[model samples]
Target: MNDSSSGRTRDPSPAAEDPDLVRARAGDDAAFGRLVAPLRRELHVHCYRMLGSVHDADDALQEALLRAWRGVGRHTGRGSLRSWLYAIATRTCLDAATTRRRRALPVDLGPASDRVPPDGVARTEVAWLGPYPDIAITTGPLGPHARYEQREAVELAFVAALQHLPGNQRAALLLFDVLGYSVAEIAAMMDTSTTSVNSALARARRMVAERVPPATQQQTLREIGDDRLRRLVTAFAAAFERRDVDALVALLAEDVTWSMPPLAQWYAGLDAVADFATEVPLGSCPSWRSLPTSANGQPAVAFYLGEDRTGTHHGWSVTVLTLRGDRVAGITSFVGEDHFVRFALPVSVGGETAVGRCS
Candidate 1:
């Protein structure tokens, strides 16, 4: 079997020779841990893409792993253990999705606001899309025939588009197009027929094609190259620190968009985005500082806001930048202190000591 985690083939007779699988089958919990430790990160990424929220993915992956442990005795060893686990995980995510509403971005709910509302409130009741820390994603595609690189699969646009799909369609698309599974394999994993899987895939393709951009951020970054991309994000962070709205606006594309999830308002076009940048982040906010970070495989920054008396900067948001050619085309600032924890960022930045960049 191929170890998708390492991109290498495993010993063909591992089901018979591997002691971890043998012990796991005999109900040794430690043995089961050893057997699954290698696949955890990638599986979590899969869950995140399927569910659209890291918290939901954490719950679903835990539930699926428990299910796998409980049912390990049923494994026939006819297929790779990776495939079996994925089948269980996908089913678990589907069940969870059925009971909950699909995650969404503010733009998905309505038309973009031309001007900021006087009292724009965070919609706590809505299950908004959450950002994924790039630390969780590995660099390459999971399989030989996979269409999207692993990073591209978890890109914000792709994951957001997945939320627009039905559970079955989403599963079929991810398993087939992203993970490089065969139609027959997906059908069996999904407990459906090849005809059904094909139908789901076709519908999913059309919907995602309509929503996702023509260029993935991974492709754009590669075109920009590392040196230039580094300089770009550095300049972005500096602009916020200096509170220079003109410097920030110079980094955006003409069709740029700025949206903060949980907040019901989003601004589109260069004019509106610049206005929001001027009014909210630059003009109204107290003190601003930022550290470069990556999210959903895109260049991002961890913004901090300092209160008047505290003299300390608190974590504000993880703003992921979507680039078009040389300029930012989209800015999705996921505002919340909880997000800082997920990215292993400090909740507070003290005076004079500079924060380091997160890769």
Candidate 2:
């Protein structure tokens, strides 16, 4: 099998010599499964990038694989199976994108609140951009020429920016830039002219550049190094567990912003965020238990809220921190019990020896 970064054009059916390919084309279901297994993980990532939700990616990938299986005989062995599968997956996501609402974060809904309100209402009408469990994300770029690493491509900023794009532009940008497909190859895969592909790519690049950060979280993390980065994340979770507002504030950058999806209100600037932190997680919430984790290639904390009489701490939010240098620059707390399962975290932390604990 060719590496994902391998260029598009090659000898027809490089895998044609494999018996499995012959069996798959000739209608062996097990053979088809063997052919698809290796490419499945990356394909799922591609779908997630396109749809901006893990649930949506799951649905799209299932449909794409089924379609590929049904059309296996017609594959003609003219291109690599991986590229063929990606084309199916990309189109599947596009079709889903047309009918579904685009995912968003709280910041997208309105201007930042200057101070904390008594409470913020959950906006169920908005489809929030959910976090990806970085454990499942591959570490490197899909291709050598790909601009974004696999983890960087899934960073909150990058995926959130993708949600703003129109379907064609989104597909073009992901295919050409993130997946490193040549314009001519993308044109063929997308069933469009090379000129059309180039135009779409140009437009997509401009819009994405406007929203995604100049420095990705991946680059920042590399500079921080593992030991210091781990300590910074540990300190962050500890502050919340101890309800130490001062410690938490100290970890934040001067212009730090805090946002929680499902909550339409967001806090920006040090004072505004500190005010909200002082009022909410540090105040209104009686107690918090935290477990250090990672998401979107950034350090994160999985919080469990107020314990029951039985001493079970219920799951709360997966808070992902975006670092600028060694300080926390942005905090995105994806608040919902539903998020925990994706990270393989239990819904409640019983009286266990988890990393961060306070009462």
Candidate 3:
């Protein structure tokens, strides 16, 4: 089967050979693992786009794999194994969406706040959008008619906009645009008519366009080149460490935005963001040390805050930067020390070092 995102035909899994298939069908765990292993990472990413949380995606993909494994015996081999697996994963995500609320950012809830609130924003009860650890993502259109690259679909802006869409609309859009599924195929997967699928796609496209920026992060990163990208990320991290608000401001676009998830407030524009820097992160928050990392396929810094007299530091937040041309256009800082656990980051730092060993 042709991978929609690439021109070359995808190699059939070694397990798809008759002998291996038979073994898997007969309930050999090792055979089954080989049968599905090739597709697991991509399928997990699909689940993430569908459901919007790493934990949720992990759970949904596991359930989908279980369902696929239990039902492997029924396969007639009329279709590509990849398509069949995707159908199951899509169904799994749809089920989860029906039961749980959509994930979102603070910006989705209300207008941008000029500065941080006195007590800080509430972190409990809200289903805030979580950052994705750096993972391989397919770039370029899935097919001749596709819209978003696999990685672009997961960018903070794109993902946030998607959360506002109704579940079915979101699914149809991802399958058709990101994964390059045909209209009829999507209808069949979603158990709807072709006409209905078309309508969903139309609405989903419009809503996403309305919410997302004109240029994607992927496009911007490519334009900037790798060496420059590294320098840019490092500069931001250095500025944060020094609490140099002006230096930070110098790197921002005229209308840059900064939002801290779980915090209802966000800052927009150079002046407002600078005000925020002076009063909040720079002024109120404790000492910081940041390590360069990537999240959602974009440059990010995981920050550690010094919390005690002994100079101990703990995971503070993961700040993902969004750029436009040569300047930073947006910053979404996902707060909460607990978040470090998800990224395999150290929970707390000490012993004459701190957040990822003093970096």
Candidate 4:
């Protein structure tokens, strides 16, 4: 559980000379960069998990670095530099969370067709769910000393579920349980008693567990390769282009669930979801296209539709599909133009299409 195995090691003695640190503390830019470089990616991930949004993580990380640079001269070497940075980052995140409410997807809001606030209203005002970088998954295996255990725990569902907990509770649980910080360490980081940290952790865990459904046994749909995933995307495009509800339904599981966040409504079962699709505005919008992408450790499609006048394509939802065997278990569509760029999806589907605008 030491720092080296955890991927948080500092430079060896001569390389990490006291004089170099002293110079860095006195405002040497190159020396300071060396000190901060090792911790950047891990700190970003930590902030993402704590804030539940990539954008927020970026902000918090910058703030933490600035704070560290400004205060570096006061470094008494009382503790590990990694821990110290984490303490600063954790406080920054807590401050941000305290000012803003938590974010949730449709499932967290409630059942299907529930009366909810308008999109970009109170829901967005409360923290909105955010995207994560795929590189976080491809990183090498974590050691026993790694701060965060179970990287999948930062998946979209898990993060969306986290929005249900109060801010302090979320911070405490992430610091103690996910990050493997000692209870006393968490207390020190949050400036609370050890007993309070324990209580917050218990409450946060219970709340998150209650909100998120247990992971069911299903086919592993994550990173199945580009070719196979493109097939699914192609199938989806053809079905939607033809406005063929039956064809689309064929791709879904019997118990398939569909949801769109911010609106706070969801549909369960094939028939119910089919009815919603066929009856909604989706029925009218034809000439659909989907580009392949990944999110929440699952295969996903970023959708676009052809513009009638310019023949250009416009943005649509990024749908993360859960597969049971070969059938689709769930389809969660994250809609909005902003989400398209944030998730690094294309503005349009790239291919020639014979299908014209459907009447």
Candidate 1: deviation at residue 45, Å? 0.5
lDDT of each: 0.86, 0.84, 0.80, 0.68
RMSD of 4: 5.1
- 1 or 4: which has the higher lDDT? 1
Runs of candidate 2 exceeding 4 Å displacement: 1-13, 139-144, 308-310, 351-359
* Candidate 3 C-alpha lDDT tens digits along 1-359: 11235562332433345676788899897888987887888888888888888889999999999999999998766666777888899999999999988898877778887555666746678788888877444442254445676778788888888889888899999888887778888888888999999999999999998998888898899999999999999999988888899889999999999988877778888898998888877776667778887888789999877743247677778899999988999999988876787777786666464433211
Maximum-TM-score candidate: 1
lDDT of 4 by residue, 1-359 (tens): 11223554332223334665678878997887887787788788778878877778889899988898888888765666667787899898888888665655666565665222233232454355765645454332332333333455566666776777777888887765556677887799888899998899889878877765555211244434557666766786667667789888988889998876554568888888887778652565655666767775666777776644236666767777776656777887776657788677766654544323322
TM-score of model 1 (CA atoms): 0.93
Kindly list the per-residue Cα lDDT of model 2 for residues 130-186, writing each as its tens digit: 999988787423545466666778889999999999988999988877777777778
Q: Ranking by lDDT, best first? A: 1, 2, 3, 4
Candidate 4: 10-residue stretch with minimal lDDT:
114-123
lDDT of 1 by residue, 210-262 (tens): 99888889889989999999999998998888889999999999989999988
Clashing pairs in 1: none
TM-score of 3: 0.90
Query: After superposition, which runs of candidate 3 have C-alpha atoms over 4 Å from their true positions?
Result: 1-17, 136-145, 308-310, 350-359
Each model's backbone clash number: 0, 1, 3, 0
Residue-level error in angstroms, candidate 4, position 249: 1.8
Which candidate ranks first by lDDT, i.e. highest? Answer: 1
